[model samples]
Every structure is written in C-alpha cells, then in structure tokens.
Target: YKLIIHTDTLIGLSFSGVHTWLEMYGCEWDDQTGAADAFDQFGYDGEDFVSLDLKELRWISPVQQGIPTVQKWNNDRAYLESDKNYFSTECIEWLQKYVQYGKSSLKKTVSPQVSLLQKSSSSPVTCHATGFYPSGVTISWQKNGQEHHEDVDLGELLPNEDGTFQKTSTITVTLDEWKKNKFSCVVEHQGKTKTENEIRTNPEGSVPIGIIVGALAAVVLLVIIGVAGYMVYQKKKGFKPVSGSDDGSNSSAHTVPQA
Candidate 1:
C-alpha cells in the first residue's frame, strides 16, 4: 500500500485555485481463476467521502455532504462505462503481463525444513517450518495419535530475505501431559523431494511428516557450482562445458567469469 497524492489545476481567467486531492484506485487480479477486481475511492478531510461501485457503475457516498457530488457523478453514464472498461480490461492486462514476466520466481515452489525448538525443558515447544515458497502451509499438533488444538498457538507467516516464507506453531504441554500421551507436531506441504532413507518404502509424491529440503538444495548447489566452474575456464584453457536439462532448458545459475 502507498499514499495516493497528486495535484491538478486548470488555470483560466474565470478561476484561480489549487486543486490538490487525496484519492486512491487500484485493481487485483487472480491468475488461477482469471478473475479481476477493481476499486476506485476518494477521501475528503480524512473521511470516506465517496467511492465507485463497479458492479452498479455508480458512485457511493457515506456522508451526506458527498451526496451532491455522488449524484452528479453517477449521472455521467459514459464516464462510468469508460472507468469500468479501463480497470477491468486494461489494468488487469498490465498486471497479468507483470505476473507472466515473473512467473518463474512467483510460481516456483520450495520445500520447507521443519524443526522443533525450545529454549528450556519447561518452555513451550515451537514447531518451526522455514524456507518454503508460495506461503501456503499447515502446521498442527497431535496428541495420542489424534489431532490436538487446545494448547497450540500458531505464528504469523513471515517472508525471508531470499523470497521464501516461514511459520511457527507452539504447543504448551505440562510434564504430566507429555508423559502420558504422545505429542507431535505435524506440518503439511506439497512438492516434497525424495530422500535416501525413506525413498525405498514411500511411494512417489508421498508427503512425509517433515523432511529437510537442504539436502536437495545442496545437490542442486553442487550441480550449479560445477556448471559455473566449467564455464569459468576459457575455451583456450580447456573444453567449455555445456549444461543442458532433459528438456534442453539451461539454468540461469552463474558465477563471476574467470579473469
């Protein structure tokens, strides 16, 4: 969100005044369902003065002081039609273009690393899941093999510096509750990677309770480093290594070229 600020004025011999107004308008686009929503609103003296209802193509005013302006603006059918058309079609197309341009990063899914943390034996246990993408995940606690919700406190989903997301869920249990029943934190996420220990038994796309994605990241890092190292060597020094995937797509991973 940003502040809406601008100035407009028509200087003529009949009138001389500054036309500074505070107003805001924007649109939201959903790529999954291809739906677009728009809003055009205005404020006056730090109050909700008027807004445009796109569906009705009419202006709405909360305060009585805005009634005259609303009634006058609502009567302009041509202006309303043009406003609706621009926001629904043109604005949405521009936003979709930007989304398409950033599809690789925006749509990429990175698996999370789940860990149970506690400051002391008596402290509440926090189930932390971090370094994930898309920000949609589930974290729950289980007691005696069943779902538990009584003492659970879910944390806010936060962004990481590398464009990933992290979340935490804490469960408070006493010594008696711990000794008598089995307590476990369950985290659910998609796009899980296969691991060596559980590869043979688990079926393809099986969602384990939790798995560290760093092993997979390490392997990818090594592959990228190898490719970058090969490119660093000039053709005169050695053979230039060609890196290509099965679909013939080359990764953008790179390092500083050798001097």
Candidate 2:
C-alpha cells in the first residue's frame, strides 16, 4: 500500500491491502512505478491495490511526533500578530533601574578636565608654563606676597577644533629672584578656580661648599710648610732672624777681642 498526505486536514490515502506496516516500509517509494515495484516484491496484489484514507487513524505511539513543527508554527503566528509596545515598556523599566542605582549603566563619566604641560626653562631661573584646555581660562603670576604683572608674557589664546582653547605664560627674573619668588598659574572655568604653582631653586649652584673649603685648606697647608722650611734654613746658617734683633744676653755669648 502507498499513502500520501497533502492537506491541512491531515488525510492520508493508501493503496492495496498491505496495511500501514507495508506503507511504513514502502515510504521510500519515489513514484507510482516504484510503489508498484515495492508491492510486487512484498507479495502484495500489484493489479488490485486498494485506496485507504488514514484521516481517522488515531496514532497510538507513546512518542508524539510533529510537536516541534507545530510549536514553531504557533510561535511564528504569535510574533506576526503581537504588538511591540510590551517590549518597549520593558526597555524603559530597565533604563530607569540603571539610572536609579547605577547598575548595568554604560555611560562614560567626564574626566577631570585638566592637563599640565612641561615647564620650560629660558634662564637659569625663569621658565614658561604652557598647557591646553577645553574652554576660556585665566593665568596669573605671583612673587613673594605681591602680584607680578610687569615683564610677565602671556601668549595669544588659540582655539582648537573641538571648541577648546590653549595659552602659554612666561615670566623673567634672576635666578636668585626666582628662588625667592613663587609663581602660579590660575585657571577659571565653569565657575571653578584651579591653580598650579612652581617654586624655583638653584639646583646647579647649590654644589657642595665643602669642596671649596677643602681646596682653600690645601693651599694654606702648602704655604705654612714653605714658611717653616725657610725659617729653619735661616736658623741653621746663623743668619739674623727676620722677625726681630737678638738681645745678646744669653750665657753662650762671650766678649771677643777685636780682630
């Protein structure tokens, strides 16, 4: 027997008296000729094949077939007919929870909004502080307890492509003045004031004083040795000492006849 199902009504037609078992075995038939060949090989009536309607045949197997296909069809229909408003509500709720507790949040916080450039030295004492920023800023200089304005050089503000600005400031003074002075750069932006100060010192001139003292000591020692040697020579040769005259009152001195 051969059976075929092609409708949503789930009807199956079988030929011959080979029953469903033969139909199961003959399911590999490719066409009408193949079905007739299988029937002949299985000892079924090739000339008198019977037509069967399997629509009322209740499947008695323990395993229920076609479950996965039915479930897929149902899911596709549901997705086609359902509204997306429920999903949008879920997304809004998730965002609210993230904003409330900062959990599952993916936003980047703004940085400290500051950068310091390298201070360049023009003289042994004076230097220029240069940097860039994202907005308008202020720059100033202070020496000791007084504000320094004269001789302070301020560079022109250059606007960056990202709407930020940069500027440089220079101050000139003696190395000694720099050591005694305190220089600061103040920036005012977004209603906030930030200040950076650089105090100068003579690192190169602060060499060891002990070295100079040691050199002087060596020169004094050589001079003392040379003077002592000259005094010893004058005493040994009976020459009058250069300091003062002898009194001639010693016991070793005697009166001598005139020669």
Best by lDDT: 1
Cα lDDT tens digits for candidate 1, 4-85: 1222122234255433334566678776777778777776655677888988888899999889888888777777877777
The segments of candidate 2 whose C-alpha lies over 4 angstroms from its true place after superposition are: 1-134, 199-259
Best by the TM-score measure: 1
Tens digit of per-residue lDDT, candidate 2, span 1-259 = 2222111111234774332211111112223353221111111122222221122211122223433433443344333222122122322232333344543223322122332233334342223222334335566666664677877777655433332344556666665665576755555644565566653444443522322444455566679789997876555223211112235332121111111
Clashing pairs in 2: 16-49, 16-50
Query: For candidate 1, what is the lDDT?
Result: 0.62
By summed lDDT, which 10 consecutive residues of candidate 2 come out lowest?
A: 250-259
Off by over 4 Å in 1: 1-14, 20-97, 191-259
RMSD of each: 17.2, 47.6
| Cα error of candidate 2 at position 137, Å | 1.7
Alpha carbon deviation, residue 243, candidate 2 (Å): 99
